[model samples]
Target: MPASGQTAERNSHLKAVGFLIGGISSFQIGATVAKGLFPLFGPTGMVGLRVGLAALILLAIWRPTRSGITVQSLKLLLPYGASMAVMNFCFYVALTRLPLGIVVALEFTGPLTLALAGSRRWLDLCWALFVVLGLYLLLRPETMAAGTMHSFDLFGVAAALLSGCGWIVYILTGTRIGRMFDAGHATTLGMTTAGVLLLPWLIPVIPTAIMHPWQGGMAISVAVLSSAVPYILDMLAMRRLSPRDLGILLSMEPMLGAISGLILLHEALSVARWIGVLCIVIASAGNVLTRQKAIAH
Candidate 1:
């Protein structure tokens, strides 16, 4: 490439990195707010309201036309929406039972596993070790005994694992969906579909949640933080970033979750747990910088 083209490419890469970091930061801030709202509305109720409201917000922004809609799109989107809906619902449920930082750290394993698959590297082993160490620190028998300690709640843990799986699907599918639909339209329509699917549960709780006033505010706040802002920033960043780069950026979610929980929700991690978080952060950053250098070469 010519000097001018190389300079332009460097500038573009820098811009993409900035957007990715911004998106991750926005998402963490949103998580803090949503977690704070957990006392008012349970995670499931909060998720329903968030998705429902986000659909409306997206509709206003995207106004996706039905003209280009196709059977394939519907088929692809059905699972996508379903995964997204269930993911948020389960994650919030886990939040109700566990620390935000721990939940996010475990949740990250799904994507990290995806990142390392089929690629043999010493660093990949290191990443796995980091995750395992973090999980052990967070879920040690003694650690559970220290706090209110429902960390081992089988159902909640299952729900969180399911959410992590769902998120993995979401990331994989999002790339394809982005190719076919504009970000605003894709996210809004998909969320709307998920909201409608979830209405069956909402039927019983909607009236009570909304009428409660406090629950209603929490619901809306979750939608804005967990869905709206991060969704927008992610959409913008996705336009400029690759999946590996996006994954690397997303690895920051756990650290941000820890910090946000500590500062915003007054949740603190033990020294061991913080070290575990550091390991994961270093592994993730290493992967990103390594991949980036390879791309540059």
Candidate 2:
């Protein structure tokens, strides 16, 4: 490639990295706000607000038509939308019940599992060990006894794990959907469709809450942060960053979540949990660095 082309490529990669990081950070902030708002909205109610408003905004922007729908496309989108809805629902459920950092840490398992599965070299096992050790530190009973963990919080932790699993499925399915449709349109339509699907539960709750300015603000913030802004940036990044690089960069989310929670929500982490965060970061970083050359091919 020419020098100018190489420089442009580098710039694009940097933007993608930035977008991935920004989106993840916004997600964490959204989580912090939602957690704070949990008392007012309840888990499902909070999700309803976020998804509902996001749906409206995205619908106005993308206006995706179902013109491209086929058995193949529907198969992909169904799972994609389902994964997104379930992931949001479960994460909100977990957020309602547990601390933000713990929930995000546990949720890291989803992408980590995908990373482990895709690797072929023995070196990948080293990264796997780091993630496993991190999970152990985050989830183990011994780690909890130090005032950083609660027994009752385990249920939320499990739900977050389910969210992680759903996220992995969402990523996999979304990749296929991306081939068939514009990502912005697809995500917009998918999210709106998910909102419609959620109406039975949301309609009963959103009305009373929507009348409150504070609750409405929080919901809009969640929509902009978690859905609108990130989705837009992710679309830009997708053009520049390969999927593997995107995953690697996206793995930084847990650490960002922890830091954002600590800073914005006044949540604290014990030394062990901090160490767990480091381990996962190192593991996720390793996956990126090790796979870089391979993925570019």
Candidate 3:
């Protein structure tokens, strides 16, 4: 490439990185606000509102037509959308019992596992061990004895695990959808599909909540911050950056979530828990870096 083109490319890459960072920060803030609204709307209700409103907003922005959409694309999108809906619902449910930081950290396991999969290197195994050790430290019996884990809810933990599983499915199915359509079209259709799938749960609660203006407003905010903004930003970033680079950037999300929880919800973690968070972040970053190196070879 020519010098001018190389410079332009570097600038665009930097701009995309900035957008990704902003998107992650905004997402954590949205999650903190959503947790506060759990009293007015249960987890499922909040999921309904977020997905429903997000679908409307994205559809308006994209104005996707069925002209190019094929039945095969629709097949890919259905499972992708369903995975998204289930992931969000389960994460919110876990949030009700656990602090925002812990839930986010636990949820990080999904992507970390994805990143580490198919690796045969001993170093990769070591990185995976760090993740396991970190999680153990974060949720171990000693932490509970110190009152640092008092809020631990077994059901919430299980729900978070389920959310992680959903996340893996979402990523796999979404990759296929991304290959089939542009991000805007794919996201709009997928979110709409998720909204439709969630109707049974949403229909029962949204009608009453819509009557009260305050509840409805909060729900709209959640949709914008959590779904619309982050998704758009992530898509932009993905266009400029390699998946390895994107994964490394995404590894910062758990730390950002922990900070947001502390500042917004006054949720504090013990020293041990902080160590645990650091371990997971390091392990994730290391895994991505290693994968990139392997690709270079």
Q: What is the C-alpha RMSD of each candidate to the true structure, in Å?
A: 3.6, 2.7, 2.2
**Alpha carbon lDDT at 182, candidate 2:** 77
- Write the number of the candidate with greater TM-score, choosing between 2 and 3: 3
Q: What is the per-residue lDDT of model 3 for residues 221-268, given as tens digits with 9 covering 90 to 100?
A: 989999888988887888898888898999988888888999999998
TM-score of each: 0.83, 0.89, 0.92
Task: Tell me how many clashing residue pairs each candidate has.
Answer: 0, 0, 0
Cα lDDT listed for each candidate: 0.74, 0.80, 0.86
Ranking 1 against 3 by TM-score, winner: 3
Rank list by TM-score: 3, 2, 1
Ranking by lDDT: 3, 2, 1
Best by TM-score: 3
Per-residue CA lDDT of candidate 2, range 1-297, in tens? 999999988987898888777777877877787777777778888888888889999998888776888898877777888888888899999877766777787777787788789667888999999988998777665435566834437778889999999889987988788888877877876797678777766787767675788787877898888888888877777777876787677777788888887899887877787788878888888888878766667
- Kindly report which residue stretches of model 2 are placed more than 4 angstroms away from their true locations once superposed: 1-14, 118-120, 142-152, 242-245, 294-297
Clashing pairs in 3: none
**Counting only residues 3 or more apart in sequence or on different chains, how many pairs clash (N, Cα, C under 3 Å) in candidate 3?**
0
| Tens-digit lDDT track of model 1 for 167-246 | 88887887688788877788877888888887765555678776788767666666676677777777677777787777
